[model samples]
Target: MSSKFKKRLKQLHGSREKRRRQSTQDEQSRVFTADDVEEQDLGIATSAVDAWRDHGADSRPTARGEAHFLVRHHPQSHQHGTKRLAEGAAVTLEGFRKQLNDARLHSADPSRLVFLDLETNGLSKTSFPFCIGIGVWEGSQFGVYHYFTPTEADEPASLSACAEILRDCEGLCTFNGSSFDVRMLQRRFSHYGIEHPLDDLAHLDLLHLARKLLPDRNGHKLSQLEEDVLGFGRTDDVPGAKIPGRWKQYLKTGSPHLLLDVFDHNRLDILSMVVLLPALAEGLGSSSDSARFKNRASKSDLGNRPSSSGSDQQARPPKAKPKTKLASQLSRTYALRKKAQSGGRRQPETRPTEQARQEDVPRETVKLAGSFSRAKLRRGMPIGTRLRELRGEVERLEREGRGDEERDEIVHRLHEMVALSPRNPFALERLVDYYRGTGDAALADHFAKRLDETSPF
Candidate 1:
């Protein structure tokens, strides 16, 4: 027998013994019937409890059992990065309702509206949440609370604690909670056989609302909005993917150190929602109300803005920055990166004449890539060739299951095709379908009307 074969046999024998021991333990611990009122309190080691306490979390008794959580109260004068959590207190209820498009929020008390964010082990139904971060308005200050699950067994206690806080709130605000957090919590509550407290609350999902109202943002992610809209940025924050592993590590090693960053990440997410609500409401407010909010925001933001020689234009609305140069650079980079990422796709070859023609077109005169200007339209690029190329690109993108990722590019090309050939029913029909699918009734109706106008009965 070879040495390698002998070692492999020993490893397999050891694993078999381990499994046998686990099965025996399971059999011995099995219970025949469930008892609802009886609590199986598994006490964590004193060292582990002390470690978590050192990081600001303390063990508290909930209706279900003992849960570990942290609570911090921020004074009204305290600012989170560049924006004050107090600014959210200034949000008009009507404007906020308009921003989220939920009438129920119009009558809801602002102080009772809670910002919720969760840290979970994974996205699957089988996955468990380890932390729940909540923000609530208390008197004249804001409060941030985090409920922690020490183990999978502690989930019931943590959820109970979270529900107790949520019970007092009339409205819930979350970044992308509609698709993930809310569903996750519902599943968890169902799993634990507990009544859900969030069912009757006015849910304001900021993700979809942000995309609709702030279309010019680079991205609508909580972190992105925190930087772009709230003017707040995090340093040394933990990536969400690694959070599950941190919990597992703590479970194995009995060390709570890895979880410190996880708590910070959750805390920042809740705090950002505190400011993002008012910022988004400012855009969705009526004209006069919007102007008032903007003026207040601008005044508060004066410290971060560059000092102007003349203060006369202090109240003037910020002007849109030119995007000609940025658009050109982004277009080129996108093409190159797309080709690189799609390993099978080869770069298209261009003729010297075509290159020279592109160079001769002045940068200042260049329009957004897909949308053409009249000056560029005058140049003799064959309409048929461009249309064929665009159709081919769309087909390729759809074939590769990237239709959703590149839908905007596809729509832009379809519009260009229609522009070049006004009677092109195919492009016009596609435009109508695309808009309708995306829930844009106005654009869909306009395109449908155009499709009918171009059709020959």
Candidate 2:
């Protein structure tokens, strides 16, 4: 019985080994069918071949055929095509003048602006363009072109094509292209011995205008700008840094799947540029109007309330009134404050009447006083004591009814106090309220601007 049991175990082991051998042989002998060949052709996995056959049998052949035909016929077309397009598409001298004229007349140019964006290998002088994307606006109709290095050896051709497109522009626009993009292009052209066309082009970089017009929010990224200004968003886009990896993947596997997303990202960048240009123009126009109105109002106020010794001076205007200097300084200060407050949840505060009249105190004196006030507060100084000191100083200034210089001196001191302890919003707000109460719009605006910057209302 023991012998029989041993024999039975040996037979089972033999059967198991046979089955394993058969499975290995079957896997090895698996036929390379048409599906496998097609999968190989499309750079798809063998397992995916079945799905392709099930769903894409008809479409695959047509796409493959077309791709092959295009590649075969235009062996060097991607490289040469770009160059041809650039040279062919360049705007003539006459065309440039015409577009500018149209822009002046209608506040818009009808030449169908081309928004250009490129993703490069890096941000250094040695960086080269791995791909280029262009979005052409032809009277509300949008066309996108994405050109990439066809082969490791075909970079020049691709770059040349890019140059051609950039050269033939009615109006060229970019986001931060002035500092980074255009400079990179110029370097690339020099390296490749190609003529840089962007040097002579009339281009507007949105970054400069953005810095000038928009509040200095942290969201200066192109993606952020697109979301905020253009009301557009993208998904499945490749991160800019991962572009090199995607290119390497395409080279290794001959799969352009990742490249498709890169193309989409580039196209979106161009479209965002298209949208941003007009929005920036509108912002600039609005800022210009506000500046003009402020200037006129400041001049009118100065004229109406001329100082006793300034009537004859006002008659001659003394080349220019000092009001312009005051107005300009106030405007700059206010603008800076407003920038700091943008996208923040703070409103400007009003100043107290007494503080407004106490504009004769020197800045150093107020700073020293505020420091003492803070130290005393920390040491359990009563709030009334602090208030009394400030009120006494303000009362003394009010009785004197000092000159403009004295008033400015007091305002300057208050500003220092506000700066040292932004938490003490009351002081800044009271100053603003005082300026408003005295009908000093510029001074009021100045405080208002500070409140905007630092207030947490």
Candidate with best TM-score = 1
> Best candidate per lDDT, number?
1
Per-residue lDDT of candidate 1, residues 338-378 (tens digit): 43335553432222244445678654454423234445447
lDDT of 2 at 10: 97
- For model 2, what is the error of residue 367's alpha carbon versus the real structure, in angstroms, after optimal superposition? 28
User: Could you estimate the TM-score for every candidate?
Assistant: 0.57, 0.41
Model 2, 77-140: lDDT tens digits are 1122112113212223232233334332233242444566777766676767766666664432
Residue range with the least summed lDDT across 10 consecutive positions in model 2: 67-76
Which segments of candidate 2 are over 4 A away from where they belong?
1-112, 138-140, 286-457
| Model 2 whole-model lDDT (C-alpha atoms) | 0.54
The reply for model 1, stretches above 4 Å from the true place, is 1-47, 288-457
lDDT of 2 at 358: 82
lDDT of each: 0.73, 0.54
